[model samples]
Every structure is written in C-alpha cells, then in structure tokens.
Target chain A: MNLYLGVDIGSVSSNFILLDQNGRLYRKLYLRTLGNPVKALKDGYASISDGLDKQHGKIRAVGSTGSGRHLAAVLLGADVVKNEITAHAVAASHLFPGAKTIIEIGGQDSKIIILRNNIVHDFAMNTVCAAGTGSFLDQQSARLNIPIQEFGDYAVKSGHPVRIAGRCGVFAESDMIHKQQMGFPVEDIIMGLCEALVRNYLNNVGKGKKIEEPVVFQGGVAANRGLAKAFEKILGLKINVPAHYEVMGAIGAAILAREQMELSHSPTRFRGDNFVLEGNFTSNSHECSGCPNLCEVVCIKRDNEVLAYWGDRCKKWESSIKQPRDRLKVV
Target chain B: MSRVGIPRSLFYYYYYPLWKSFFADLGAEILTSAPSNRHTVERGIELAVDETCFPIKVYLGHVAELCREELDYIFVPRLVSVEARSYICPKFMGLPDMVRALIKETPPLIDITVDLSCDEKCFQKDIIRVGRLFTRQARKIQLAYQHGCEELRLCRSLASQGFTMEEAIKMWEGEPMEAESETDLNIGVLGHGYSLYDERISMNLVKRLRAMNCKVLLPEHLGSEVVEAEAATVPKRVFWTLGRKMLGSALHMSQREDVDGIIYLACFGCGPDSLIGEIIERKVRDNKPFILLTVDEHSGEAGIITRLEAFCDMLRRRRNYRSESKLSPYGASLHSFENTV
Candidate 1:
C-alpha cells in the first residue's frame, strides 16, 4: 500500500496523519506545538514513520493546512497547501456525507462551516476572541485541579448546568470564580463552563448563519463529551463525532493530497527520508526595511543557501530567490 | 503660495481631485499626507483610543504624518452630510475636533462645513466661507468651485468605468489608462472607499484580484439613484451615507449574474459595519460565494493571501462544476438544502 501524509500546524497543536491509497486513515498523532512548529512537525513525522511497518506502505504525497500552512509546506515539501476551512470541510463531508454543518473548536480559534451538498456554502471563524476554545477550557481545568480528560465526565454527571457568561474570556473567568464562591458544585460548574463554550461558539462563530443538521463536531475540543452534549442540547440534534476527531485537519489534508495527486497525475514531491531526516535546515527572520511597512520576513535555509523568503508585504525579497534549481528544491 | 495639507486616509480618493483643483485655482499649494505604512499604523495605534476602528487610526497616522510637513493650514473638513436626510459617520462629524484635541502644535485648520442637508445655498455659503481665507472676490470663489466640480465629474466617471483612484487621477492628468485588460471572471468588492481604496490596508486587493484575471467592481462604480433603489429593497434604509452606499451596492451586485463572488473588506471593530455586514450576509446567504475579510493593523499578508487563494479556488471549482453538470449554481442547489425536508 502507498501512504499519503498530511500535517496541520495550528497555534496550539500540530497534527499529523497517514492515509492509505483507499483513503482509509492508517495512523494519526496529535502533539502540542509549544510555540515551535518545526520541532513538532519533525518529531511527529519521525514517530509516525517509525510506526509504519516496512511491508505496509511507502510515503507518497504530502499536504498541509492551518495557520502555519506555509511553514509546513516549506519544511515538508507539501504537494498541496490549503487553508483549514477547505481541509476541515472536505474531511467532514467525506466522513458524514450528509453533514450540512461542521463546528470545529481548536485550541486558540474556532470556526463554523455550513455546507450544501458536500460544498462549502458559508463559514465564519473567531476573529478576536479565544474565550470558548480549547485553551480556555485547558486553563480552567488546570485551575480547578482536574484532569482535562475527566472534565467531560464531571459535566455528564451534573444534574443542573448553570449559565456562565460566555461572551469573552475575562468575563467567563470572573463569572466562574463568582459561581464557585457562591457554593456551586464542581460538576455543575464544569457543566456550566461547557455550556458557556457552546453558547459562545454559537453566538459568535455561528452568528446569523443557518446551522442545519446533520452536524459533525471535530477538533481537539470535540474530545470533550460535555461540550458535545451541550451543543446537541442547544441545537436539538444528534451531533456526530468522527473516530479520528482530534486530527481531522490532518486527515482532511491527507485526502486533499490524494485528490491533487490523482488529478495532476504527477510524482509525489516527498523529498524522501534522507532530505527530511538528515538535511540541515535552519530558519531565521529579519525586518525588511525595503519600504515603510517594515515587514518581518522569514527565510528558511538549507546549509547556508536561502530556500524561500515569506511574510513579505511587497514581494521584493520573495522575488529575489529566482533560481529554477532553488525553486524546485525549496518551495 | 500658502500650503495646505490633506490627510490621504478617508474620502481622499473620492474628493482629492476636487480639493486639489479647488486649492490650486485659489492660488494655494495642496500637499497630501503620505500613503499609509506600518509606521503610520503604529503611530496611529500609539495615539488613538483602543475602541476606535482601524481606518480612523490610519487617519490619525495620516494626520500625524501631515503635521511633519509644516504646512500653513491643514484641510480637515467636517463632512456632516452629502445628501438630504442622510448623515455621515460620527467620526467624520467629529474628526476635526478630534485632531484639535489630540495633536499639539498643529497648524491652523481650514475647517469647512460641507453639509448639503440644509440646502444648496448652505453648501455655497460654506464654500464661500473657506474661499474667503484665500481670496476676497466672490467671482473667483465661484469659478474655483465650478472647476473643482468639473474635475470631480471626470474622476467619478473614470472610477465607475473600473479605473482605480490612482489610475483615475492619472487619467484626469491626461495619462493613458494602464494595464486594465479585461478578464472573464468578475468579483464585486463591497467596502467603504477608505478600506477598499487604501493599498496598504487592503493589501492591494483590487490589483491582486485583477492580476488573477478578474474584473473588480466597487460601490462608487454604480449610480446613486440605482444604489438607492437597490437599498430600498431592504426592510429599513441605512442612514449613514457611506454605509447606505456600501449596502446598496452589495445588494445590487448580489443580484448581478455576471458577478461570480463578493468579497467584503471590512475594518476590524467598525461599529456600523458590524451591523450592516450581517445584513449583507443575510441578503447574500447561499445565493453567492461571500467572504468577509476583517482587516486591522496586525493583519498578516500571508494569511490574507492564503484566504484569497482558497476563495478563488472555490469559485473556480464551482464554475467548473456548474458547467459540467449544467445545474444552477446560484443559491441552494437542488441537491442541497433539502436536509430539513
């Protein structure tokens, strides 16, 4: 079997997934990004590569998504680099063919995607708020001295879930403290937090959009059954959580890579194990004062040779790397 | 000649030529503030209140830039209204006062009230009041106003015909229209003139779309009468002049079959736009492919480029799918939206 790889590098977490030629997921791994994407991708790739039995498959094509997609594409020689919106929608519609809506709650950001017949109709992402996302829940779990894995179990056991203000993180935190001081049970407070997150996601990300069923919930936050239950109760529908919920972005990217390869009929630009494992790659950034904007441009290098320059407002620096040999070898 | 500086932020692209010709005809030199850059935005961020919109902050930056020019007077006008019964944003109404309060050691401001809400005579009186500072003759002021109007008419025509502000200004100066080749794809860009026209904030969106072989449409391109008619189709009419114009033009473009998609470039934390944007969203619904890009000073170029690429790819895919399947691509497809039924 031939394997396709997908990597999703977000702010809080980096996900890696491997899929066979038949579009079945073989292996998936979710790891904390911890502010270093290059390290996360390298470590995730190594562990996934080790798990692969020699008789099973060889890596064929690679795709990347999420906010740090460009960095991943440059680091891994991605054949297809896409946004998280497309990747998530693709995976959701693929798994639950009738999924009309997808609510993806990640660590730092959340998004709602409405689909029509397996096509993205409308979508909105959280712009300036990170209150109801996975990071917020993680902070509350740490403060409450409860393991994150057991948070949903506590909420599920609650008979009454209180209403916590979910408009902003600051408001939610203060409200949680106030509720705790007022003698609310820990399970009830946990359930309230889950409800607050669902409400925030609905009002902000799902504002004014038609959110029809069959809805599929995925992302790192979807692991919390408490949040899933709250969403199902508020929306009055059965929310489907796919088996590979945490790494859906990676799965979607892998599916896109397979589609692109089949459509173009080209050989995969995987660069093989030697280039990824043994090659010395170093990245550095500098403020380009070419114009008054003073854009901070990041450049990746392979043994002191510039591979690509990005984050440039005016392509002055990016346009300078114009060697065909370097072009194919780099981006 | 006495020098007067104009900040090139809000309404500069729309009325620059008029003001330029008006000032020049009165024998006064006109200096425009530099185009918005990162330094300008940073200065604005440092000076402006946190609650203000991004464009207003950019305007402050422009004003700060203008302060360095050592002009005799800065032309900061109080634009209350352009048409009868319509108001402008409160920021425009209080801009000159804000400048006076915020910036120290400012040159004398040539503040003029151009409110057409009162009557035509009031507009004439306002112009004449500002004109007296330059010349004492009534005939000279009248002639300058007429010349300004003529130049403005030409600029508006050029802009409506798909010329950018820079291109239109160049055309008004007797230069050839440059690199405006036509493409099959058409995209309607809905936003205030300030956000859509500013290359720095918009990240050169019009040029970027044009480079991808798509014709860009703006609200200013449509006639006011047509826009008003389109706006009346909604339940309640928008009161703000620019807000009404943006909403009207978006509604008009949503009905246009040639327009493949609509991209709304909005300012982050814009109060009026946050409300009107929802209306535009409800109107467009699933009828068209709509993408709302909220831009602020901290918006990253790579992220915007990625979204643009994804949106363009989606439009292309929809076009191909429609042509292949010969099904209606507009609104909810027959195979879609039947889940509830």
Candidate 2:
C-alpha cells in the first residue's frame, strides 16, 4: 500500500494523518505541542510508524500545514506546505461536497471560509486577536477546575446563560469571575462563555459574509459540542462536524500532497521513518547585523549539516542554501 | 549652501520629489533621513506618544534621525489640506507641533503651513518664505518652485508606470531602477502612501507580491480624474485626501477585469483608515474579493505570509475554476480531485 503523510504543527497541538492511495484515512495521531513542536512532531511520527514494516506500506509523500508549516516542511521533506485556510477549505470541501461554509477555530486563530461550488469564494481570519479561540477556552476551563473534555457537558446543562463580554479575552475572564461572584450557576456561566465566543467569531471573523447551509466546523475546537451547538443555535443552521474534525488540517495536507505527487509524477521526497526517528534535528537563530534591519535569521540543521535558512528580508541567508527542494514552489 | 533635512516619512513618499527639487534648486543640499529600519522604528516608538498612529511614530523616528545630523534646518510642514474640499489627516496638521513637543533638542524647524483648501496663494507665499532661508531672490524662488513641480510630474509618471513611489523618487534623483518582470497575477493594493511605500512598515508587501508573480496596481496608476469620478459615486464625499484616493482606487479595481483581488493595508490605530477600510470593504464586497491587512509594531512575518499565500491561492483557484468552466460543457470541475486514483 502507498500512504501519504500529513503533519500539522500548530501552536497548541500537533496532528499527523496518513491517507491511503484511495484518499481514505488510514492512521491519525494528535498530540500536545507544549510549546515545542519539534519534539511533538518526532514523537508523533515515531508512535504512528511504530510496528509498521515495509511490507505494510511505503510513505509516498508528505504535506504540512498550520502556523509552523514552514518549519515542518524543513524538518520533514514536504511536497507541499500550505496555509491553514487553504488546507481546511480543501479538506472540508473534499469530505462534504456540499459544504458552503467552514468555521475553523484552532489554538490561537479562528477563520471563516465561504466556499462556492467546492472552491473557496471568500475567507476571513481573526485580525490581531485570539480572544475566542481554543487556547482561551482551555485557559478558562483550567481556571474553573473543569476538565476541558467535560466543559461542553457543563454548558449543555445550563438553563439560562449569563451574558459575558467577548470583545477581548482579558475582559471575558474578568466578566466570568464577576458572574461567578454574583452566584450565577457554573453551568450557565460556561454556556454564556460559549455563546459569547460564538458571537465574537461571527462578528469578527464572519463579518459581512453570507454564511450558507451545509456548514462544516472543524479544527481542534470542533471537539467542543458546546461551540457546535452554539453555532447551530445562532446561525439557525445545522453544524456538521466530520468524524476526523480534529485532524482535518492534516487530512487536507495529505490530500494536497497526493494531488501534487500525481500532478508532477515525481519521486517521493519523504526522508523515511528512519531519518525522522533517528536524525538529530536542531535549530538556532541569531540577529544578523548585516545592515540596520537586524533580521533574526534562523538556521535549521540536521546533524551539523545545515538544512535550511530563513527570516532575512533580503533573502541573502535563505538563498545561500542551494538546495532546490528547500524553496517552496507552490503550484 | 545651506543644509536642509527632510524626514523620509508621511508626505515624503508623495512630495519628496518636489521638496528635493525645490531645495536643491534654491542652492541647499537636501538630506533625507536614512530609509526606515529597525533602529528607526524603535527610536520612533520610544520618542512618540503611544496614542499616535504607527506612521506618525515612524515620522518621529525620522525626525530623530535628522536631529542627529549637522543641519541648518529641518522642514516639518504643517499640511492641513492639499486640495479644495478635502483635508489631510488631522495628525499631519499637528505634526510640526508634535515634533517640537517631543524632540528634546533640534535645529530650527522651517515649519511651513501648506493649506491649499481654497486656493494656492497662501501656499506659494509659505513656499517663498521657506526658500528665502536658502536664497533672498524672489524670482529665483518662483522658478525653483516651478522646476520642483515639473520634477514632481516626472516622478508621478514613473509611479504610474508600475514603479513604487520610493523607486520613482529614486529615479527622479537620477538613480537607476529595474523594471518589473512578467507577472501572472494582477493584485490591486490600496493603503496610505506612507505605510504602503515604506518597506519596513509594509513588511516588503509589494516586493513579496512581485516575488509571488503578481503585478501590483496602486492608486498612482490611475489618473486623478478617474479616481475623483469613482470616489464621487459615494453618497457622501470623503473629506480625507488619502482616504478618498483609496476608496476610488478600490472601487475602480473591483470593476477591473485584469485585477484578480484587492488587499487593503491599514495601520491598526489610524482613525481615517478605520472608517475608510470599512467603507471600502462594504463597497467592494460583492464585486471582487478583498482582504483587510492591519499591520502594527509586531514584526512577526508568519501571519503576513500565511494570509498572502492563502489569498493568492484563493484567487488562483477561483480563476482556474472559472477558466475551466469555459472549456467544459459540464460547468466547472474540481481540478485538484480530477486525477485522484
């Protein structure tokens, strides 16, 4: 069997997925990044490939997405490195053919993608604010001494949700504390928090856009049934959460990788499981005094052999590496 | 010869050619602050008040850069209105006062008030007053101002010919500029000239777009008549000069066939931009795709790169699907999934 691998190294979580030749999900793994994507990626890869032999399948190609996509591409020889928006849109459209809207709220960012005829017609991401994202929810849940998995259950039991300010995260937390001091039910407060986050996402990320039916909600936050229910209640439309909503970014990347491989008919750039598991990969950054820009250039190395360089505005350091594959040639 | 300093921010992108020409012709050597860099932004943030917009902070930094240099005078103009019925931003009107209040030590400022709201008579008088510092001859000052206007026309022409204002200004100063290469995408970019033209401030937005095989279209590319006509389509007239120009440019681009999409680069705390950006977004919402990118002191390149890449991907995919629809009888096909075996 031929398997394509997809990796998403986000701020809060790292996800890995494998797609078979027929574009079916073969294997998936989700792990906490814990502020270190490199360790998470290596550990996730090792766990997914453990006990798998050459007779089982060969890794054909690799794709990466999310905020750390460029870093992921450098670590793993990725055939395609796409932004989260494109990856999410592609995955949603592929799974739900009639999906016209996609609401993706990840660790630190939320986005609304409007699709028309299976192509992205318009999209908007939260600008300079992560107030209503998964990280905030996680912080609130942790402060309330409620397990994140059970946060939605608390919301579902609420009779009336109290209004909390959702414009800013700091204000929302204070408002939640205020509501708690006022002796409001904890369930009602949780449900109020969910409603407030939904309002923020719609007003900020989904502003001025017409969101139609067949809306597909994904990303790590999609696991929260409260958000899905809130979205359905507010938009007055059914929210469809796919079976693999948490790893949709990884799945989309895999689909894009498959498409790229088929289009180019090129050999797989996969470094293999041995290189990923055993290769000592390290990265370091230094401020380049080359002129007054003082760009902090970062260098990634694999066992002392420099793998890639970036962060310079002039591309002087980036171009120093002559490897053709290091350059992101998006078609 | 008198040495005059001009901080390269704000109106510098728009009026640098005229200032350089007028000062040079009046027998004064023109010295502009070094192009904005990390130190410039840092110093600007340190010296400027926190409430001011990013461009104003950068302008303060440029002034600080000039104060370090041995100079006769620094020209900080109080620009109220450039044309009739439209004013510049309110911050620009108080820029000279702000500089005086903020900078600890500085050369004597040749702060001239250029208000052409009703007529250019007062502006001409102020121009001669500034020129008198360099030369006493009134006839010589008039000729120099005329020469400056001629040079400004040449620079504006260069800008309309697909060069950035910075490049055009450099070209006007006899510097050689490389022409843009062939591009696959036509992206219409709108923003205030100060923020848009400064490479450091805009994070090399135009250069990045060009590297991505995009031909950038700016408001300078359109004639004033065209811009004014498009801007007049709004029910209420835009009172801000740059704001009006941006709205007109955005409206024009939304209807242009060659243009794929529009990107508005706005400073986070700009008052005029807050209103202008919202209006442009609503006006161009239905006609074409638009993305509002608000940049600030944060220098993280990841968010910018991701947004640009995704925006370009959206435009390309939409274009491909539209073109594919033309070829097939069964409407548009999913190009990415066609070869899935």
| Candidate number with greatest TM-score | 2
Q: TM-score of chain A, model 2?
A: 0.98
Off by over 4 Å in 2: A325-327, B325-341
- Whole-model alpha-carbon lDDT for candidate 1: 0.82
DockQ for model 2 equals: 0.49
lDDT of 2 by residue, B291-324 (tens): 9999999998788888898899888888877886
Off by over 4 Å in 1: A51-55, A323-331, B170-184, B211-213, B301-307, B324-341
Error of 1 at A239 (Å): 0.6
- Give the per-residue lDDT of model 1 (tens digit) for A175-292: 9899999999989988998898888888888887788989999999998999999999999988999888888888877877776666568787676666666657789999987777
- Candidate 1 per-residue lDDT, tens place, B237-306, comes to 7888888888888888988999999999888888888988878877885678888888888656655665
* Model 1 docking category: acceptable
DockQ by candidate, in order = 0.33, 0.49
Candidate 2 lDDT score at position A154: 91
- Please give the lDDT score at residue A40 for candidate 1: 86
TM-score of 1: 0.92
Per-residue alpha-carbon lDDT of model 2 for A66-149, expressed as tens digits? Answer: 988888887888888889988898888888887999999999989999999888899999998899898999999999999998
